[model samples]
Target: MAIGLFYVILLGCVLLNVCFYFYFSKVCFSNPTTYTKNVTPVSVIVCAKNEEENLKRLVPQLLSQDHPNFEIILINDASTDDTRFVIEEYMAQHPQIKMVDVVNNETFWGNKKYALTLGIKKAVNDHLVFIDADCEPASNQWLSLLSSPLKNDTTIVLGYSGYHKAKNSLLNALIRFETVLAAVQYLGYAMRGNPYMGVGRNLAYTSKQFYDVSGFMSHMKVMGGDDDLFVNEAATGNNTAVVIDPEAFTMSKPKQEWNKWWIQKKRHVQTSKLYKTKHKLSLGLFFTSQIFFFIATILGFLFGLQWEAILSLVLIRYVIVWIVMGKGLSRFRESELIPFFPLLELLLVFLQAGLFISNITHKPSRWK
Candidate 1:
C-alpha cells in the first residue's frame, strides 16, 4: 500500500509538469512582431526616491531615445538627496524632460502609488510608459519598440525587465533565475490570452484605461501593487500584449544583499493575495506542483518503489523542461542561465514554499 501511494504521488507530479510543458510548447513558442512605423507620442513616467546616482546614469538614456515624439516625466518623490538637483540639471539641457516634485508632508506620508498618480495626471500624452529610476534601456530603440504595440489597440503593453548579469554569487544566480522564471510565466500567460500582471520597471498603458479601472484605488493602502495589481485589475485578454524583442528589454540593478532581496520579494508576494481568482489558482497550481514533484521524486528513489517507472518519469519531465524552457530562455536573452536551470529550479521550489508561508504572517512595509 505504501509503495502504491508513492506511485500515485509520483504520477501526479509528472502529470503537472507535463501540463506546464504543453502550455509552453503551444502558447509561448513564437515572438510577436513589433510595429515601428505608427509610433505615437508617449509620456515616460519615472518615480524616484533618493536614487540620484541611478537617475544620472539611466535618465540620459531615456532622453536620447530614438523615438520621434515622447516626453520624459520624472517624479521626485520628496527625495532628501541630490535627486532634485539632478533632474534640474537634466531639464536645463533637455527640452522634453518634465519634473514633478512631491514634497514630503510630515503628517501625510504617501507611498509610490501616490507619486505615480501625480505623474500620470501631469502627463501630457494619452499613452504613459512607466519604469523605475534604476532601470536602463537595453537599446536606443527601446521606446519605439515598447510603445509600438499600443498602435494595434493594445491597452496594456508588457515588456521584459531583467537584472544586469553579475560576476559571481549564488544569490545573483538565484535572483536572475527567479526573474527569468517569472517572465516566462507572465509573458506566456499574456500570450495565451489570460494576461494578468506586468512589471512597472518596463510597462506601458493608456491614461484612459488607468482611469477606467479606477487606477490602483482597490489596493491603494497596500504598498508594491502599483504594477502587478494594477495590471491584474485593468488588463483583459484582448486588450493586453507582450513584447520580448531584445530592444524592448530594460536592465535594472539587482539587489546584492540577501536581506534586501528577501524584503523586496516578501512585499511582492503580499500582493498575490489580491490577484484575480483565475491567476491565483493557476499560479498556485504551478508552484504546488513544483514542490510536490521534487519531494515525491526523492521519496520514490529512497523508498525503493518502482525504480524503472520513477527513473522514466523523472527523465521525461527534465527533457520537457529543458526543451520548453530552452526556447523561453532564448527569447528572453537568458541563455547563460540555461545550464543552471536544474539546480535553480529545485532550489526555487523550496524557496517559494517558504515565501508563501512567510507571506501569510508578515505585514508589508511602505514601498521604497
Candidate 2:
C-alpha cells in the first residue's frame, strides 16, 4: 500500500510539472517573450516612511526616465526622518516632482494604502506606476517598458523586481531563487490570463482601474498587501498583462540576516489569507506538489524503494521545469540558480511551511 501511494504521488508531481491544470503554464513557456509599449503620459508614485537613504539614489533615476511626459509623486508617509526634506529638495529643483505629505492618525497609523491613495489623488496623469523608494529602475527605459503593456484590455501591468546580487552569501542566493520562482508562477499565470498578485516595487495600473475596484478599501487595514491585495481584487485575465524585459526590471537591496528576512516573509504570508479561494487552491496545489516531490525523492532513495522509478520521475520533473521556466530565469538574470534548483526548492518549501504555521500560532507585528 505504501509503495502504491508513493508511486501515485510521483505521478501527481509529473502531472503538475506538465502544468495541464488547465494547461497551467505550458502556453507561457512556449510563447516567446514580447512587450507592447504605449508612450502614454504617466504618474510615478513612491511612498516612503523612513527610506531617506534609498530615496537619494532613486530620485535621480526617476528624474531621468526616458518617457516624455511623466510626473513623480513622492508620498512622505509621516516619516520622522529626513524623508520629507529629501522630497522637498527634489520638488524645489524639478516641477515634475510632486509631494503628498501624510500625517499619521489613530485610524490608519502605519497604513501604506492610505498614504498611497492620497498620492494617487495627487497624480495629474490618469495612468500610474508604483515603485518602492528603495527600488532603482534597471534603465532609463524602465518606466516606458513597465507601462507599455497596460493598453487596450490590459489595465494592470506587472513587471519583475529583483535584488542586487551579492557574493558569498547563501541568504542572497536563496532570496534571488525564491524571487525568480515567484515571478515565474505569477507572470506565467498572468500570461495564462489569471494574474493573482504583483510586486508593488514594479507594478502599474490606471486610475480608472483603481477607481473601478474602489481602490484598497476592501483590505485597507491589512498589513503589507497594498500591492498584491489590490491586484487580487482588481486584476483579471482580460485586464492584466506582464513584462519580461530586463530593462523593465526594478532592483532593491535584499535583507542580509536570516531573522530579518524571516520576519519580512512572515508578514508577507499574512496577506495571502485574503486571496480568492480558487487562487489559494491553485497556488496551494503547486506548492504542495513541489514539497511532496522533494520529500518523496528522499524517501525513495533512503528506504531503497523503487529507485529506478524514482530516478526516472526525478529526471522528468527537472527536465520539464528547465524547459518551461528557464527563459524566465534568464530574463531575470538568475540562470545561475538553475543548477541549485533542487536544493533551493527544498529549503524554500520547508522554510515557508514553517512560516505559515508560525503565523497561524502568532501573528507578526506591523512595521513602517
Candidate 3:
C-alpha cells in the first residue's frame, strides 16, 4: 500500500509538471520571427567597472545595431582599469557613442544602480534599454526587436540572456542549462501574468515607469539589486512583456571557475527576498515543489523504500523538468546539448539547493 501510494504521489507531481509545461509553452512565448521596423526612440545604458576588455568588443556590437534613433550610454563606474581610456578612444572615433563618468557621487554610494541612474538621467530618449558590459546582442536588429514590444506596453520588456559558448566542459553545459531554465521559468511565468525578475544583460524599460517605482530603494545597499531587484519592483501584470525572439537575445560569458560562479549565483539569489509578495509566493511554491520532489525520490530509493514507486516518481519529476527545459532550450537554440540533459538536470538541482542554502546564511556577496 505504501509503495502504491508513493507512485501515486510521484505521478501526481509529474502530471502537475506536465500540465504547467504545456500551459506555459502554449501561452507565454511566441516565436519572434516577425521583425518590426524602427518605432521607438531608445537609449542603451551600459554600466562598467574594469571591463575594458569586454567593453572593446561589446560596445562596437551595440553601435552596429540596426536601430534608427538610439544612443549608447556607457557609464564608467570608477574603474581602476583603462575602461575610461578605451571608451574615450571609441568616443573619439564614433560620434554617436556617449560616455558618462560615475566617479565620486556622494548621494548614491558607488554601485551599478547609481551608475545606471546617472546614465538614465542624461539619456535623451524615451525608451531605456539596458545591457551589461560583458554582453553582446545576438543580431544587429537586437535593439529593434527588444524595443518593438514597447508599442503595446510602455512599462517593461524582458529579454533573454544566455552564456556564450565556451569550450565544451560540464561547467559550461550546466551554466547554459541554468540560463535556459531561468529564461523558461521567468518568461513562462510572465505568460501567466506573474512576471517576477528580469536579467539586466538585456532588459528594456521606460524612464517614467522606473521613476514611478522609486527605483531600487528597497534593495539599495544590496550588492546585486540593479537588475533582478529592479525588475521585481518595476514589473506588473498589464505592463510587463517578455521578448523571446532570437534577435533580441543577449549573450554573456559564463564564470570560468566554480567558486566565482557560486559567488555570482549567491549574489543574484540574494535579491529574491525583496520581491513582491505574489512573486515571492510563486517562487516559494516552485522551489518547495522542487525540494519535495528531490527529497521524496531520494528517500524512496534508500532502504528499498518502495524502489519501483520511487523510481517511477523520480522519472516523472525528471520528465516534467525535461519537457519544460527542453522546450526552452529548443527555442533558445540550445538543443545541441539535449543529449546531456540528465547530467545537466542533476547538477542544477544540486547546485541550486547548495546555493539557496548558502544565500540564506552567507555574508553580503561582493562583485569581485
Candidate 4:
C-alpha cells in the first residue's frame, strides 16, 4: 500500500510537470502575437557603476544599432573608475550618445532603480530600450525588433538577454542552462498573455508605461528588480509583447565563480518573492511539482517498487522537457547544452532547493 501511494504521488508529479511543459511547448511552435513595424524614436538607457572597462566595449555596439533615430543614455551610477571618462569620450564623438552623471548619494548608493530613474527622466524619447553595460547587442537589428512591437496599445517588450557561451566549464553550462530555462518560462508565459517579469539586460517600455506604475516607486525599498518588479506590477495581456527574434537578443557576461553566481541567484530569488499573488501561486505550483518529481524518482529506485513504471514516467517527462527546452536553447544559441539536459535540470533542482534554504537563513545580499 505504501508503495502504491508513492507511485501515485510520482505519477501525479510527472503529469503536473508535463502539463506545464505542454504549456511551455506552445512557445516553440506558437506565433502568439503579430506586431507592426515601429520606427518610433527610442532612448536606450544603460546604468553602470565601476564598469568603465565593460562600457568601452558595450557602448560601441549600442551606438551601432541600425535604427532610424535613437539616443543612447549612459548612466554612470557614481562609478569610482573611469566610467565617466569613457562616456564623455563617446559623447564627444557621437551626437547620439548622451550621459547621465549620477552623483553618489549614500542614501541610494549602488541602487540600480534610483540610478535608472535619473536616466529615464532625462531621456527625450517616449519609446525606451534598456541594455546592460556588460552586454553587447547580437546584431544591429536588436533595437529595431525590440522596439517594433511597441505601439499605442503595446507598452512593454520583454527581450532575451543571453550569456557568452564558455567552453569546458560545467558552471558556465549550468548558468546558461538556468538562464535559458528561465527565458523559457517567462517568455512562454508572456506568449500566453501572462508576463510576470522581464530582465533589465534587454527590455523596453514606453515612458508612459513606466510612469503608469509610478516607475518602480512601488518596490523602491527592495533591491534588484528595476526591470522585473516593474513588469510584475504593470504588464498585462493588453499591453505586453515578447520579442524572440534571433537578432533582437543581447548577450551579457556570466559570472565565472560559483560563489559569485550563488550570490547573484540569491538576489534574484529574493526579488521574485514579491511577485503578485496569482503569479506566486502559479509559479509555486510548477516549482513544487518539480521538487517532488525528482524526490519521487530517487525513492522509487531505492524502494524497488515498480521500477519499470518509474523509469517509463521519468523518460516521458525527460523527452517532453528535451523537446520544449531544446527548441528554446537552439533559438537562444545555447544548443550545445541539449545532450546534458536531464543532468543539468537535476542540478538546477538541487540548486534551487539550496537557494530557498539559504534565503531563509540569510537575507539576500544587495547588488552593488
Candidate 5:
C-alpha cells in the first residue's frame, strides 16, 4: 500500500508540473506580434528615497527617452542624501521634468505608496508609467512600447524587468533565473486574460484605473504591494495587457548580499497573502507540487523504491520545463541564463520554500 501511494504522489507531481509548463507554452509562445502606433501622452512617475547615485545615473536615461509627448515626475521621498539636488539639476534643463518632495512624516501608510500617491496627484496626463530609480530602460522605444497598449484601451500594461548580469556569482545567476520564472507566470497569465500581479519596476496603467481602484487603499498598511496588490484587485481579462518586447525591457541592479535579498524577498512575499483566492490557490498548488516532487524523489532514491520510475518522471518534467523556459527566456531577452536553468531551478524551489516560511513567522518592517 505504501509503495502504491508513493507512485500516486509522484505521478501527481509530474502531472502538475506538466500542467504549469503547458500554461507557459501556450500563453508565452503565442506572444502579441502586432503593436499599435498609438502614441499617447504619458506621465512617467519615479519614487525614490536615498538613491542619490542611481537617480543621477538612471534618471537621465529616462529623460532622454525618444517619446514625443511625455513628462517625467520624480518624487524625492525624505532623502537624507543628495536626491533633491540630482532631480533639481535635471529639472532645470528639462521643461518636461517635474519633482515632488515628501517630508518625513510619521504616517500609518508605507512611504513608497505615499510618495506614489503624491506623484499621481500631481500628474497632468491620463496615462501613468512607473519605474524605480534604480532601473534603466533598455532602449529609447521603451516608453513608446510600454504605453502603446494603452492607446488600444488596455488599462494596465505589464512589462519585463531583468537584472543586470554580474561576473562570477552563482547568486546573480539565480536571481536572474527567478526573475524569468516570475515573468513567465505573470506575463503568461496576463496573455491568457487572467491578469493578477505586476512588478512596479516597469508597469503602466491609466490614472482612471488607479483612482477607480482607490489607489492602494486596500493594502495600504503593508510595506509593499504598491504594484502587485493594486493590480491583483484591479486587473481583468479585458483591461490588462502584457508586453515582452526587448525594446520595452528595463534593467535593475540585483541585491549583492544574501541577507539583503532575503529581506527584500520576504517583504515581497508578505503581500501574497492579500492576493485573490484564485491566485492563492494557483500559486499554493504549484509550490506544493514542486516541494513534493523534490522531497519524494530524494526519499524514493534513499530507500531504493521505484528508482526507475522516479528518474523517468523527473526527466520528463525537466524536459518540459527546459523547453518552456527556453521560449520564455528568448521572449524576454534573457537567453543567457538558459544553460544555468536546471541548477537554478532546483535552488529557487528550496529558497522560495524557505522564504515562504520566514514570511509567515516574521512580519517585515515598513520601509522602501
Candidate 6:
C-alpha cells in the first residue's frame, strides 16, 4: 500500500512537470521572434575531428553566411585523417577563414573543450558562434538570425539544430525525437526565464561573456562541457535568448547505431554533474518521477492490483507524456513523429534509466 501511494505521488509530480513543460513550450515560441539587427563582430567556430568528408560540404556552406562582419574559425583537433588537408585547401581559397591545428593531447583538458578554448582565444570578434564540423547552416541568413539577439544585453543565443533528412531509419527517428526533447527542455527553460544549457552544434555567446565566466576553466577535466556547462554558468533571466527562426537552423548527421548513440548520450551526461544546483535539482526531480512511475507499474502488475486501477494509471501517464511531447513536436516542426510517440517514449524511458544507472556507477564510457 505504501508503495502504491508512493507511485501515486510520483505520478502526480510527473504530471505537474509535464504541464509545466507544456506551458513553457507555448510561451517560449509563441512569438517566433528573432533578435534586433546589430553589426556585432561575429566569429563562427568549427571544431573538426576527422571530419574530412563533412568539411568538404559544410565548410563551404559556413563560409557563405551573409553576415557582413563575421569570420570563420576552424580548429583542427588532432585529425589523423584528411581533415587537415581538406581544411588547408579551403584556407588557401578563403582568406576570411582562420585555422588552428591541435594535437591529440588530452593532457590537462578534454579534447573538444580544449579545442573550443583555443578557437575562442584566437577569435577577434565580440560574439562567438560554435558549430560542429558535421553541421551546416540551413540558410545564408543563419548568421544574421543567430547574431541578431546581441543588440540588447542578450549575451547567450541558443539556436535550433536538427539532423539531416537524408536518413530515414528507426535510429534516425529516435534521434529526431531526442532533438525535439532537447529543443523543448532548453529552449523551454529560456522562455520561463531560466535557461540552463545550450547545444554546441549551434549556440552563440559574446566573447566577453565567455571570458567573464572563465571559459570552461572549472569543468576542463571532464570530457564534456563545451556547450551545456558553459551555458549553465553564462545564462540567467535577462542575459539569454533563444532563436527559433527556421532559417537559423543547423543540420548534422544522426548516430548510426544504438551503441554509438548510447556512448554519445553518456558523454553528454558526463557534464550534467557540473550543472548549477537549481538545474540539477530540476533534472533530478524530473528523472526521479519517471523512474518511480515505471517501478510502480511493474509492482502493481506483479502484486495483482485491480486491473482497472492499473489501466487508469498507465493511461493517465501516457496521456500526459503525449501532451507534453505533442507540444514539443508541434513547436519544433516534428509533427510526423507524433504517430510513433508511444514506441519512442517507451524506448526513451528505458534509455534514460540506463543512463541514470550507468551514471550512478561512475564508470567511464567509451566515446563514439
Query: TM-score, each model?
Result: 0.96, 0.95, 0.92, 0.97, 0.97, 0.91
Better of 2 and 3 by TM-score: 2
Write down the worst ten-residue block by lDDT for model 2.
20-29
The list of candidate 3 runs beyond 4 A from truth reads: 1-12, 19-23, 27-29, 33-35, 105-107
Global Cα lDDT for candidate 6 = 0.80
List of clashing residue pairs for candidate 6 = none
Per-residue lDDT, model 5, residue 283, is: 85
Tens-digit lDDT string for candidate 5 (39-150): 7799999999998999888877987888889999999988889999988998999888899998867775446888899999999999999999999999988988898889
**Candidate 4 has which clashing residue pairs, if any?**
none
Point to the candidate with the largest lDDT.
Answer: 4
Each candidate: what lDDT? 0.86, 0.86, 0.79, 0.89, 0.88, 0.80
Alpha carbon deviation, residue 318, candidate 5 (Å): 1.0
Q: After superposition, which runs of candidate 5 have C-alpha atoms over 4 Å from their true positions?
A: none
TM-score of 1: 0.96
Ranking by lDDT: 4, 5, 1, 2, 6, 3
Say which prediction, candidate 3 or candidate 4, comes out ahead on TM-score.
4
Steric collisions counted per model: 0, 0, 0, 0, 0, 0
Question: Could you tell me which 10 consecutive residues in candidate 5 have the lowest summed lDDT?
Answer: 25-34
Model 1 residue 142 distance off true place after TM-score fit, in angstroms:
0.5
TM-score of 6: 0.91
lDDT for 172 (candidate 5): 87
**lDDT comparison, 1 vs 6, better candidate:** 1
